[model samples]
Target chain A: MMTAQIKEFPGVGLRESDFEQRKVLYTEWVPNARYAWDAGVAIGRYLAELKEGRLIGVRCRHCRRTVIPPRVFCEWCFRPMDEWVPLPDTGTVNTFSLCYVTWDMRRLTEPEIPAVIDIDGTHPPVGILHLLGEVEPQAVQIGMRVQAVWKPPEERTGSILDIRYFRPVREG
Target chain B: MTRKVAIVGIGYTGCRPLTAEVSYKELVYEAAVKAYEDAGLDPRRDVDSFVTVAEDFIEGTSIFDEYTPDQLGGMLKPNVTIPGEGIHGLATAYLQIASGLVDVVVVEAHSKASNVLTLPHITAYAMDPVYNRPLQANPIFIAGMEMNRYMWATGATQEQCAQVVVKNKRCALYNPTAAYGANLEIDDVLAAEMVAYPLGRQEISPHADGAVVLVLAAGEVAESLTDLPIWIRGIGWCNDAPSLETRGWGRAIYAEGAGKMAYQMAGIRNPMEEIDFAELDDTYAYKELQHLEALGFCQFGEAGILTAEGVTEPGGALPVNVSGGNLGCGHLLDAAGLRAVVEVVLQLRGEAGSHQLPDVETGLAFGWRGLPSTSGAVVILSN
Candidate 1:
């Protein structure tokens, strides 16, 4: 677990008089958990397929195109996706950003760059978002070749985080 | 092309950092009920159509539109959702009424950011999953980059940026519903913890929970329903080129295009003079200044100095964000845009009370869909 040091603004002219100094307030307010049934079920099915070490893509029968991050329907044709096919994980980098921070607005000791890898083997390039580990931020170029780093079976969750990250694949 | 649309009724819940008493559904109902009562009509029967503004990622739920109808009393009607800013949703409703397809439309926008467990994680979902999120940079980093470029290109200083917060927070002191009201000084803003380089925590709009609803109808219907109907003279919306690397970082191209389209439609050539006041999306202090420059209120990089000159204050040449804007008032996502419209309506109807500006006849409300990409809306309102 990562923790950040909290810093507060010091007294400055008017603000010193207007607000209470050295005060912090935290409240626990939670909303009712409500899920959209159809969208929930669709994502559930997609996760189930990922656990078996097989990449799945939802195929739009009408357009004969496969969509990654599996959608219930094709955006263009407005037709239901009837077939699911295995996809190749190898892909090229389309675009990337080098992040030097963490999730909670805290600066990370070591920076990491997250990239959107477009898998090469599928038509229209099945793109999956994941971290780019063991790669220097400056060396990350558009269209760079990369492959997935799968987690051990015991550590896999039915979630996108199951893939630890994608690393560069050396050419022979 | 046929019917002229006017806003007959409007209602807004108070902006707060957190509303612990109510659920998201209950908050929506409160605003919708107030709007219905103000219009003197039944939400079930009188409302012919419904439009809601929300994004699946922001709300932490997918297909969020599915559960919204029950709260707004639009159980089964011609209802649709726009997964963008609230002003874009309003523009869609306005066009529907103008086409004579719908006689009356009810638009609702709400936000419960307090409920989200991790806001940064939710914001990460908005990035182009393949490339942008991999950077692991928080969304505020983008604001930092934008501010850095704006200063580099226009020669604005960090002090000028800090001054915007000082002025707006002071203006908010007079606004009863403003959540972050303070008698802040530039030094206070500068001394505050820095979230991103050149962008302090005070410069950003605080996350908030609230809702806003508006009832719009054709001119004939509005005239018969209320004595003071705020006319929608023109509406325009546009999106910028998505890639941050390629787009102009210093200037708001999206806002410029939308403002021009709206001003052209409203037949107003000189916006700085003709317009009484304006409500701009001030999610960040720099954004307020950046948008003002883009709206042709001032030249690029001049907005920071113009704001420091008190030009945007209540008694200044053009009072901007009289309702305290998103900075003073807490930011409520989709509701932020409609809240601006509500303020304009209140001012036009002589109902803004203490925060009201002088001789307000026509006002412009601008909304920007922040971060990852730029999307914006500009609407002209007249009494």
Candidate 2:
């Protein structure tokens, strides 16, 4: 039995007051870095189409998978994608969550419903991560049909946020 | 049978919610010194190369590699930083030794997670900027969604997930290095405040500050260094599509792919029988079941049933995470994988003391870089 000497764990748990005092003696810096992120060739076209109230995906003939959030190359085949395929604005909810917290770990009074909406026309099971609106948290279910609620044409931007959210598409 | 790599020595700081007494550099130095001393070799002379694992965004320092080498005694020697997780560093060291390029290598990984005030936001930034990051929702929801899908697909109830919290935390009680170990009932886990639907506060591993340093040597070098070196049998890592749009909601393709590669390399045909035990990523409670299935421990839905039947307990058949995993030991981020490796090595050496298991010969350690991405690494070890 090789029992090593167990030393008292050398970590300290401090309160906000202790942290504040320590910060007073040292210089603190806040990062405000910004990025211009070029949308690149594939996503550049995808976002441009989103601004025009359309959803499109790139097609790879080799793998025969139509992928959303389009990329220039087929991740599976490692070949340049050739054709663009327009997809339906409506889709099914693959999965969802009722979140009571924000990205910064702050509590929210109302829960945010984030979900993966599987687009209707894509060959593969391609689902985009986005928010769900106009539906009760308890009402959300996997395979539930939904449609994109786009921002008015005049206010649309070349971004994912161009479509505000996905809402339950009423059954006819 | 060209060459064999073995873990000659291992050292790590205790897991804690905060390490305010020392800077991150000092933490690395502490572990490095202990590991070198344990191996009976001076890193300044014996270590041919070095690898450190860290993610820049979490550290608030861009290109954090610049600050690593000096602390590990790799000053001007061949040292490189891996921007992924710890198991990846171990794999890199394993490759270096097997390639006949280095006789001995040092692998270091650490996390000063307490220093990051906006961890969730920082992690959310890892999402696709054009499609996912704009949602501004808490990243835990990703786990929530996955858990929901997993439950629906595998019949794994939330109660079963809570049971995992109970089991791992209870196991942690015997581990002196486990900081978040606790005694609680499954009901307690269920009653904890919900962070995201189906995922409660207790179900998520709290972040901790810690570091792990390991020394690896090839063949005779290992034989000369330590009488009880743990041999590396195999290693593998893989990633699913980096986009949320294409990833499977109910399965862990990454773990399956990585585990298959490693199993093939190790010549392992029946993992559940041949491998003595395992330490897998339990950063999220439900992930234990998910990874178990992905690693081929059982069929797609059988892991939840096995957990309910006590098949994964320390004394049970095919023991898993006997070291309490990330759930009880606290999540060490990039260092998390090494924590599992450290536990596996100690158990294999019969040096885990109170937590030691009898007659264990081989073990597996697996790690995932954690969400918004689906990358994983696996390493097999034997005594």
Candidate 3:
């Protein structure tokens, strides 16, 4: 038997009424539905580009910086990104993680390896985060060169999945 | 040596899983008003500086700093907003007072998560767009991965992780303001809906709506205002590698580093024996265990077994999260850290009511910024 010293302090004990009040108050404040219109359009555009087998990023005219995951404005320069540049799919892996569990905690028979790729052909090391396919998790190394694998044109959506995963490229 | 700072007054709005009766601004004002009254000072005249903690992504607004002053009664005060946890904001306030730059500082943090339409989508924005977001993997999945890694590294079991939720929620049953309090069995937690593999909904903290405010003053100022002033004995905060993949997911290196820094400053070597109680961040059940190891409460991976053995429960060895923690109380983002401080102050002052621990001469409060972001703060408070 563990005898831990217990001290008494003054205040009301947890009241059933308090819990009931809090539960009701919390449920009532929850927003039932929320939608982002711009995000939807952005996804549609990205999916369309993916189907075309071209990797595009939004470039800021003022800062001349390209964002791989294209955005309307350059976060750094606070300027609208109007130029769409097709970026070379080859890049080096900056970091990666292997996920052995599913979103809902069901153990996966096969794990997925995701990597942050610093794609070539862009200033300031334009990077994109995506799946690392055709490579063993143990073999994948930081700074290893990889190339993007595009899905067939018919199945391409301008979304990120358009390029299935980045595969290791053999250097000449 | 720096001038000591003390918490002269602390006030919190009743916490609920959600609050629809008031807007975010109104919620902040209610707590700020209570804190001002408790300090026996008028916010408009006495407060020399004001600090608020909020995140643009969480609040679903850009330039969130612009909207804080109107509600906090800082119409023309030196107010700055921090884009992190409330403890970071409090630490900033402590520095300002120690520098003799401010005499009295008010720190406020609140969350209105219930106002957001889609929390998952909002959280998805935090993911790396090129790879991680493409998978539509929920943020909680990262926690799952980390929990799995922690267990593998430390040889802890799922049962131990589930026990954390069981312990915290049960402790919360003694806290009147805890939102998720209930009589729960460990099996109940294990059987709850799994949001991510190895992680269940019960393992995660419910989103909550509430605000917490604290009035900080220099030692002399505090002595003049209040009979009992909880001294800020030590404060430490640090950030680890931002790339989640590059860092070890199982252990909290940042928290361990921060805790050590704080303990050193507070002259504490044996934390388990020196500290009376603690309020650790339990955003996820595994987080509490991970932090316990990091905070040196027990050996690595021993938290699971210790928790299963009822070591963290009230009346157990070094009671933890007596205010129910984020799991039972609710996750209020920036306010979560301040809530820990508030609980510690309450316990130390013997004002915690039903949830107070044994003679709390020294209390520690810890906060974690959560996944994909590695920031933590450790504050040691004493009466």
Runs of candidate 1 exceeding 4 Å displacement: A1-172
DockQ list for all candidates: 0.01, 0.01, 0.05
Q: B1-383, model 1: which lDDT tens digit per residue?
A: 56899999887887888776666766776788789889877777788998999987666667988867766768777889888788998998999999999889999999888877677766655666555656767887888999999889888888888877887778777777778888888899999999988899999999778899899999999999999999999789888887766778988899999988988889888889889899999898888888998988888888888888889888999999888888888788888889889989999999888887877899999998877668999899999
Using lDDT as the yardstick, the better of models 2 and 3 is: 2
Ten residues in sequence with the least summed lDDT for candidate 1 chain B: B124-133
Best by DockQ: 3
Candidate 3 chain B: worst 10 consecutive residues by lDDT? B125-134
Go through the candidates in order and give each one's C-alpha lDDT. Answer: 0.82, 0.88, 0.82
Q: Looking at model 3, give its docking quality level.
A: incorrect
lDDT of 2: 0.88
Assess the local accuracy of residue B381 in candidate 1 as a C-alpha lDDT between 0 and 100.
99
Give the per-residue lDDT digits (tens) of candidate 2, residues B23-105. 67667777887898889887767889999998878777689888777668787789888888799999999999999998999
Report the number of the highest-lDDT candidate.
2
Q: What's the distance in Å from true for residue B278, model 3?
A: 0.5
What is the per-residue lDDT of model 2 for residues A1-172, given as tens digits with 9 covering 90 to 100?
2345655546775678876788433433344333223344666788899999999998889887988978655545434578999998999999998999999999987889999999988878898999999998888899999999999999998888989999999998
